[model samples]
Structures are given as C-alpha cells and as structure tokens.
Target: MDEAKRVEEGLAGDGQTQLIKEDCQGDLHKKLDRNDGGDRVEDAPEQPMAETAEEQLQVVKQKSKRVATLDAFRGLTIVVMILVDDAGGAYARIDHSPWNGCTLADFVMPFFLFIVGVAIALALKKIPRIKDAIKKIVIRTLKLLFWGILLQGGYSHAPVDLSYGVDMKHIRWCGILQRIALVYFIVALIETLTAKRRPILLEPGHLSIFTAYRWQWMGGFIAFVIYMVTTYALYVPDWSFVAHDQDVPRRYAVKCGMRGHLGPACNAVSYIDRQVWGINHLYSMPVWQRLKACTLSSPNAGPFREDAPTWCLAPFEPEGLLSTISAILSGTIGIHYGHVLIHFKGHSERLKQWVSMGLCLLIIAIILHFTDAIPINKQLYSFSYVCFTAGAAGIVFSAFYIVIDVWGLRMPFLFLEWIGMNAMLVFVMAAQGIFAAFINGWYYKDPQNNLVYWIQKHIFINVWHSERLGTLLYVIFAEIVFWGVVSGVLHKLGIYWKL
Candidate 1:
C-alpha cells in the first residue's frame, strides 16, 4: 500500500504541479527543484528594490492632492489685503478699527506672514540633500534682503515741500520689506539649524519624511520672549523712551537748551535718530514721533510736551531696531501654526474646530477689552492688537481650508489666485505710483467735466441713499476690473514674482 501511494505522488510531480507549488511558495519550490531534472524548468525574474520604492512614491503623490488648502487660504488673505488697501477710506464700511484696536484691515499682514511660514515648513520636506537645502535658503534670504533695501529706498526719497520752506530729510529705512527680510532670514535659519530635531509631542504621527518639519512652536516661543523682553527693556517708562514724571521731562528739556517746552531737538528719540541718521535724513518721524506723542498725552484734558522724554532715545525711530523683534515674533507664531496644519495630518480636523471656536471667542473678548485700558492700535502693534488681528486671520484661513480643501470646492474667482500668485508684483505696482496714477486719472478731473464724477452724480447718487456706498462700490469695482486684466495677463504669460 505504501509503495502504491509513493508511486502516485511521484506521478503528480509534473511541470504543471511543480508550477502550482512554486506559485504558492517560491522559496520552497526553489529548494525542491535544485536537481538536474528540475533545472530543466525556467526560473522567474525577480523585481528590483528600486522599482518597489518608485511604486511607493507614486502612492504618496496620489495621496498628497489634499494639501491644496494652504494655497486657498493664502489666496483668501491676498484678496482681503487688496480690498482693504484699495479702499478710499474705512468710513461707513465694515472695515477699519476703532480707536486703539484692530479692524478687518489689521488681519492681512499676520495672514501673509503665516502663509510664508507654512511654505517654509513644506519646503523643508522636499530637500534631496542638506547642502542643496542650505544653498536654496541662502539664495532666498539674500533676495529678500536686497528687495527689502530697495523698498526702503522708496521711503528715503525726501518729501519735498514746495509751499513750505521746510527742507526735512525723509529717512525711509524701516518698512514692509525690511520686516519681511528680518523675519524670513531668522525663520529660515531656525528651520535649517534644527532640521534633525525630534518631532514635537503635539505633531501628527502619520506624517512622511517630507512633512516632518512642522515643529515651529520653539521658534514662536523664542520670538515672543525676545520681543517682550527687548520692547519692555528698551521702551519702558523709567528705563528708556518713556518719562518717569514731569520733573524728568523738565530736566531733559532744560539740558537740551530748549526754552520752557521740549522741542524735536529736546526729544530723546528724535534727537538720537537725528544724530545717528543725521538731521537731513531721519526716517524715524512717524513711528518715533507718534510714540513720543502718545507717551506725553495727559490723562485729563491738559497741556503736555510735544517731544518724547530722554528715555525714548533708546527706541527713537519708527522702524526702530527693537520693534522688528515683535514683528518677527508675530510672523513666527503664524508660521508655527501653518506648519502644524501642513505636517501633522492626525489632529488637523480637531485643530480646525478648536481654532474656529477660539478665534470667535477671542474676537469677542478683544472687543470687550478694547472698551477700556487699551485701544486696538495697529501702528503700535500692541499685545491686544496682535491677539485680535491674529484671531481674525485664524478664522479666515480656517474657513478657506474648510471650503476649498475639506469640501473640495473650486475657486470660482480665479483672479484672486492670480493676484496671490503675483502678490509681489501687485504690491510693487501699488507702492510705485502705478495704481495711484491710474486711479487718479479715473477719479480726479476739473470740476467742469469729469467722467466718473459726472457718472457718480447723475447715476449712483440718484439711485443709492448713501453716495458713500456707491462711491465705495465704484472703487471696488474698478479695482476688481483692473485686477482681472492684470491677472489674465499674468496667467497667460506664467509670470510669478516671489520673495
């Protein structure tokens, strides 16, 4: 019986049977078929390791289509920026802040900075080699720095007063570009140096190597600490630009050779700025003077010195060296949150929900708080101002993400995306008198016969209750129309200008 079974098994060991066994267990088949007879059959080809990796990469690419939320958020921010900036004035509009607090207009800059930070986090993931990454960062940093200086040049052109005999030098060293350069360089360096650091506890666990650099909370902490300490130390009442009492102000005025009151020369910040930058070219007027004016205001209705105290000397200029720290902190915080959304996929939904609720509550709290103690002021970049503006920015970005990314909705207004793509070009055009020149042509004319003015009087004023609303709508319509033409050209030519 055993011999009959063995003969039957041997008969079953044909090429078809062996092929079936090999398909089930290739390793076992290889060992069984190592004989002369078995060697007659052909061996299957093995797949290369590189081919497997390529397939895995293709899978990742397909999965990454959902990250377009960042771009949509950026586009929304840019649109708001353009609208607020081009508005003739905030009067009778939902825009503009109340005294000493923020408005819809205040949220734009923080949103821009946050978008930049998000880009930084995404870029860190695509670097093929560390050396290449460092090189790219250096190149971008230099470009931003150069562009910042060029923008500063815009403010440096002395403001000529043909009517008045005053020949004041216009010092334009500190501005938007300068701030961008400072923030970009510092944030980029932080990202590069800490490239190999471990992920934070709050970060998402399912991220790929390309998405692991979202841990920017450390940068945020550093920026906040530096800004608070530096501003407090340099601008506090007793230690720096602020006055301790009336006696101190009087003593400083006496020392500066001014009569009873302190003039610009007697003001510590102005004097120092004039000394450092020279009287012929002091770019510190608006900011430093504004700060001085605020510090000297009387608690009750009474006379106060026009000039800042001697302590103000330390942080005398508008684009004062120290204030940049706070601006940078604001940017870092924005970037940190942006990176969190991009890298960690696990907590994003929860984060979105929390951010939405938090921002709504924060806006309410800020409005209440602004009623007393401090007013929301963008010029000062006050703590409450930062909180209020950032909260608004958060809400805006979150909404964009929900609609465009989560819900997979299309951007019907492609023009906004176009403007966003060429944001630098748009900004430069606005700053360099191009848009002003065009708008002035449309809006201004001799009283005898102006086209837009005539249209406004006959049509808009006749139809609308408030002419202001009509005028605003006209301005907004013109802006959108102009942007449509510019964006169309940009899209056709594939022109994108980034810093």
Candidate 2:
C-alpha cells in the first residue's frame, strides 16, 4: 500500500543537486595534488588521498533515491483522474473514448497501472529472498483487493441508479481499483516467479542495459500475444469496434456491421460478464441519462430502450475478464519501463531509452489500429488501446522527468504532491460520493435565490453567460482545490492510508 509520490520530496533544492561528471577525477584530482604541482585548490577534500567520489555517489543515490520526474508524473495522473471523475459533466472530450480510439480520460487508468508497475520495481529491488518479496506482495495484493471490494460492493448510496447511484440488485462486481489490484497480483507474481536476473547488451562494448529480467519481459510479450490471438480468434460472435445509435432497433440502423454484431445480445465481453457475475451484479450505468452517449443502450430501463425490465439487456463491463488480460499487459509494459529507469545510469541515456521505447509502442499501436488487428477499445482492452495509452504514458513521464528532474522546475507541481501523497484515500472518498454530498449540502436550488448557483453564475458564468465554462471553473476551484487542500493537510500531519 505505497503512497506513490506526485512530486519528489524536498525538491526545492536544499541539497542533492550536483553535476554528474563523466569522470569524477579528471579536474578535481590533479588540482589538489601537492606532488604533481596541481592548481591551488582551496576546497576541503573528502580524503587526503582522493578515494571517495564513487562512494559518495552511491550514498547520495541511495539516500535521495527517488526520481522527481516519476513522482510528478504519478502525481499528474492522480490529479487529472480526480479532475475527470469530478468534472460534473462539462465537456464530452473529457470523458473516456467510447469503445475505440484513445482519449485524455482513457489515459488515466493505464497510467495508474503503469505507475504501480514502476513502484513495484522501486520497492522490491533490493530484497534478498523471493520468500520475503512474496510475503510483501501477498499483503499488498490482499489489501488492494479488499479495499476495491469495499469501495465497490460494500459502498452504497441512498438511491439506486446508473452512472452515480448504486443498484444493490445490480451492484458492479468489478471496478477501477479492483482491476488495479488484480492486475498488480498477476504482475507481481510474474515478477516474483521470474525473479532471476541476467544482464543483456544494449549498449556499446561491455556496457549493458538494465539487468535483464528476460523471463518477465518474455512473459509480457507472451501475454500480449495471447491477448491478441484471443481477441482475434476467440470473439464470441466476432471482433468488432463499431458504434451504432443505441436508440434505434438493430435492423433499422445504418450499421458498421461490427456494432450490430457486438449487439447487447451477441457481445462476447458482456456474455463473459453475464456468465461469471450475472447481469444483476453488473453495472447498469445510465449513460444516456448522464453522458448523452448516442451509441449505447440499457435494455432494462432507459430512454433508448423504454421497455422497462425487458429481455434485451446490452450489458458490458469495461473491467471484465477479457479486458483484464490487456490490463496485465499494460502493467507489465510499465514494469519493463521501470527496469529501464533502474538499468540506465546516465540521465541522457535514461531519457533516450524511455523515449525510444514509447515511440516504438506508439508505432505498433497505430499499425495495429489501421490493420484492424486490435483497434483502441477500452471495453475490450484491445492491444492497440494498451499500446497507444502506454506509449503516451511513457512519453508524458519522460517529459515530466526532463522538466522537473533535469531542469529543476519543481515548484508548480508541489501542490500535486499533496494529492499523490494520499491518492487512494482521496480516490475512495471521491468515489463514495463524499465530495458530492458535501457539495449538495450547500448547493441547493430554490425559487428565491440559490447560493451556489448565484456565486457560479455571477462570478464564473457571467463572463460569457456560458454555463459550461462557468461550471468547469467552479469545479476546478471548488472540488479540485478542496480535495487538494485536504490531502495537503493529511500529508503535513504525516497521515497516509494504505492497508
């Protein structure tokens, strides 16, 4: 239950800033030597005989070991996720990519999984025995699973509805945190089982890349391939990424074929979910009521399918069994990137390696998208979807690393560190509609004069009288900042929620 950092600790530059010289001895060694008649160096030497630069590097590396950039990247993901989740229905673009293609919203979940992978490498790197690592992994996995269930199955609302309220009759068995925990368990087990390390050459001469965990890497490749083959061959009816008007009857629609093929009755993912958890336990999100999705349906009850409690239930879980495979691949890819971070020593090399890997994944993802091998579909957790999102994540993390770690621009992101410090706590609270309840308490509308609306309309909306713009602004100032302040207070008090 590690609190992944949103910003590096103590990054206002008190200490830990030093130029990484190509060789430590070239300039300083000769200048301090009395026998060689070197330049008169008035500097206080670590030893009368220069014997501790490497030693100093090792200690500094260990003591201030965190990469500021990675923490900021992790922080960015956390904050953006919270923002999107609490957006209060402003822009369509802010939402998840419907079925296929990548979007800003879609990137949040994979980035989270990726960070988990990186965190695993950082936390478990120096452990001496597999048994110790297994013990810790089991504890963390169980904690995540338990919390995920509590957040999803146990947590409830006053009324039952899709999108916002919980339906006790149809409580979603799977969820975001549940998916994360499950993926973590799978990847952690893979890393532990394939724990043996062997060096591989990716540099010139004797220089090698990160100590190659070839087995883990191979496992990632195998898992990805399996996902692809299964997606291609094992589709219930067929592999499809088509969008159809959810309101219309199946026969009347000008269909993409894939859509009608993956209809509520025929979709393989939904079938798996139905068989495993039953439709009653599945999430009956009212997408039509909330996001105005043109190409989705609720067979039980909705504007599209007005026949309440009908037999035509089009249920699909974004975090279903099939998609979990892709989630694992997403996390495994992150573990590989973590290895790159650990394996590469020089800052330049680190950036180079990360960028190159990102570009490669993006290229493959695009190629797959065009070829119809695996379109970027989050519902199915398509291979191309994982690739595109993961590639984008790597590039983003690299940029953060460069700006914050390399260039020392760490001030703006300090606030995000607050959210990153106690991310799970904040996430759970937000998910349980705690923030919404707090907002609702004072956010009432009456015939006389509504207070919350007055402030928003007069202050934010009156600019252009565009309620959308005003609403967005109000959300940023009110919800986002409010949560940030709470997390900051908790961080200051050294209170964090883990297992």
Candidate 3:
C-alpha cells in the first residue's frame, strides 16, 4: 500500500488507540514506542506520511542549529562595548570619534542593531505558529523597552517626580531606552504586519508595505536625506531658505519664543520635542546641548552645573539622534540581507564574497567622499559615516557567516557565546552602576575610583609599570572577568534574554 494508505490502515486497525495514545504520551514516548505488542503490527513497520513529514521537520530543525559564527561576532561586539565603556582612562586613548569623523568605537551600536535585525529574521523562521510569533515579538519588544528605560533611570539617580511645574525637568526625555523602543517598535511592526514573510522575495499580500529590500533601501535613503536636509537647513541656512547661523540653541530659543526663555540653553530639538510631544515625553532635550555638557565647556560644566536646577536639562546630542537613524537602517539592511540569504540559499558563498568586496570598495569610496564634502563624523552620523561603518559591518558579518555556518567551525571560546547570548543584559549591567560599583568597592582603593584607574595603578603601574602592554592586558582581563560572571550566570540558568 501507499504511504498514506498505510498510515490510514495503521490508524484504523490499531486496537492501540489507548495503547498508542499511552505509548506516545508525555516525555516518555521514545521508551514507550520501544515496548513490544504496543502499537506495532506484525508486518514491516508502517511509515506514515505525517510521521515522515514530522521526521523531516525535526531534521531541518537540527540542521539549523544556532549559528556559532554570528554568536561569536556578537560576543566580540559585546566584549568591545564593555571594554570601551568601562575604560577608566582618557577619552582620546579609547578610540572615540573626532568632531566629524568615525572611530573604532563607532561600530559598536550599529553592529548591535544589525545583529538584532538578523536575529529577528531567524526568530520568525523558528516560530511555526503565527499567533505565537506575534505574541513572542510583542513580549520581547516590551521587555527591551522596559529594560532600556530602567537603564536610563540609572542616570537620573532619583525618584520620578510627577508634580506640577516642570516636574518633567528632572526626567530625561531621550535616552538609550527611547532609542531601543523606537527601533524595536518599527522592526516588530514591520515583521508582524507583513506576517513575517520575506518582503523582497515573497509575493505581495494585503499587508505588504513594499518588498523588504525596497523598504530597507527606502529607509536608508530617507534617513540620509533627512539628516542632510535638516542639518543643512538648520545650521547652514545659506544652502536653504532657512536663516543662516541659526545655531541649535538660538534656533531653539526662537521657536520656543516666550517658553524658550523659561528654559536654560537647551538645544532647539528639545524645544521642538516639548512642543510636539509634550515636555514629559523623552527626547525633549536638544542633542548638541547634551554633548557639550558631557564633553567640553558649557555654562553648566564643573561643580556649579553638577548641582544646578537645570543640570538634567542637557541637550540630546547629534550623535544620539543620528544614531537612531543609523540603527533603524542597520536593522532594515540586515532584514533585507537575511531575506536574500533565505531565498537564494545555494549562492550564499558567491553572494557573501560579492557583498564583502563591494562593501570594501564602498568604504574606499566613502573615505574619498569624506576627504572633500562630507567629513566622517560619528556625532552627525554623516552619510559618509553610514557608508563607511555599514560597509565595514557587512564585511565582518560576511566573514562570520562563511566561517561559522559554511565551514562549520565550532567556537573555541564557549564563554564568548555565553556573553553574546545575553548581550543587552550584560551591557545594561555594566552601563548602569552594577559592575562599576562592585569593582570599585572590591578592587579599587576608593569606592569612587574608576576601574581603569585601579588597573593602571595596581596592575599596570605596580606590577608592570614600564609597559603599555600590561595596561592592555589588565583591561582585557577585567572585561573577561566581568563578562564571565554575567554570562556564566545566564548560561547556568538557561536564560536567554531576547528582545
């Protein structure tokens, strides 16, 4: 008999309804199926079509094991984030961006956002049921937003005041959480509304906004245009109808009119945010204003500004806003590429190589572009910045996909994978005061002493005082120890925090 008929016969002839039911029930199924005279027939074992499909599915699932290459790449990014963030040294040595140029540290956040997009694609593939997929996405997005907001609260270091008269003054409007929330919402909305279909390759449905690739390309284009147009219009008015020399603060003052006078030297964006979204909303702060406070000489700088009433009113900073756009593009680009990977499977190697080489050429072109009109500023997230950094990320990701997935190389350092699994959580812990407090109290002479200072003095200065190598080693060691503790616990508990 055919496979379908055999399956039908087995189902009909089996006195084994209860017997087979009992056999296949619960987690003891394999052992039960092994029992004699249970559901077995006297002839050759019947192969049911349903069983065949299930077995094939199981095989596919097994073959699609988590890509270690991606995990390792993610692990490397997380480790770098910890190192640069925790470094207790001068900003110059830590590879920060120049006023209008990219730096080694510039890649961290975009890498993170890109990985998130990749994971979203992978996750949707794993979810067999649409209802469950939607539920999971919603919950995960909420968790990420919640955690991000909680992290922002760390900087506030005070209770959220909800009283009258600029009670919003103490609350920050834009922050790490705000950015995460925006990205998560946009990506999740796209995935859900499109029913998790590969936008570029899949046939258009009622929900299809556009092909996934098209959407991503459009987003990137729009972001680049908005950044350039808005900055030029506001700052360099000669190029546009808007007035020239409308520095951010002055422009903000003009827009606010009477209300502007009430606030201190907040950025114009902050005032706009307040007008549009209410003062209580996050990101109401101006961007440049915040950066000025953090970096150089501001009226609020030093001891006086530290305790000023409007001390918390720092501007949002350009990099901070531009980073949002970059982040969105990063995810969109990853999603588009993921669709390409899924639909055009066999040509992966060729495609990967092509993308890598193309990106390298693109990077060179961007560098040339930077030499003239567009400087590569991380703060502004200039077009050249996006081109250069995205190109670099593409090359890196291509290498990872090739080595880990294609070559089937196992990770030598399992600990890195562990760290990568709970990357966002690890970042929050380090970014907040958790690890910093512990290190200061346990290792440093003073609780207020920075970790880098301790390493420089004790590990570097005392032990190997003459060498820069000692400091570097100490930095690496400290990061490993911190990540080991964080990732170790996550691994032990089998807790993979996703968002």
Pick the TM-score winner. 2
Error of 1 at 408 (Å): 2.1
Q: Give the per-residue lDDT of model 1 (tens digit) for 134-210.
A: 67567666665566555454432311111112233443455555656666667756776776673543343433322
TM-score winner between 1 and 2, please give it.
2
Question: Which candidate gets the maximum lDDT versus the true structure?
Answer: 2
* Residue 142 alpha-carbon offset, candidate 3, angstroms: 3.2
Q: Which ten residues in a row have the lowest lDDT in candidate 3?
A: 5-14
**Which pairs, if any, clash in model 2?**
none
For candidate 2, what is the TM-score? 0.74
Query: How far out, in Å, is residue 238 in model 1?
Result: 11
Q: What is the C-alpha lDDT of each candidate?
A: 0.46, 0.59, 0.48
Off by over 4 Å in 2: 1-62, 158-169, 198-211, 235-265, 286-302, 305-313, 438-464
Order the numbered candidates by lDDT, best leading: 2, 3, 1
- Quote model 1's TM-score: 0.62
**Residue 287 error, candidate 3, Å:** 11
Q: Alpha-carbon error at 235 in model 3, in Å?
A: 6.9
Q: Indicate the residue-level lDDT of 125 in model 1.
A: 29
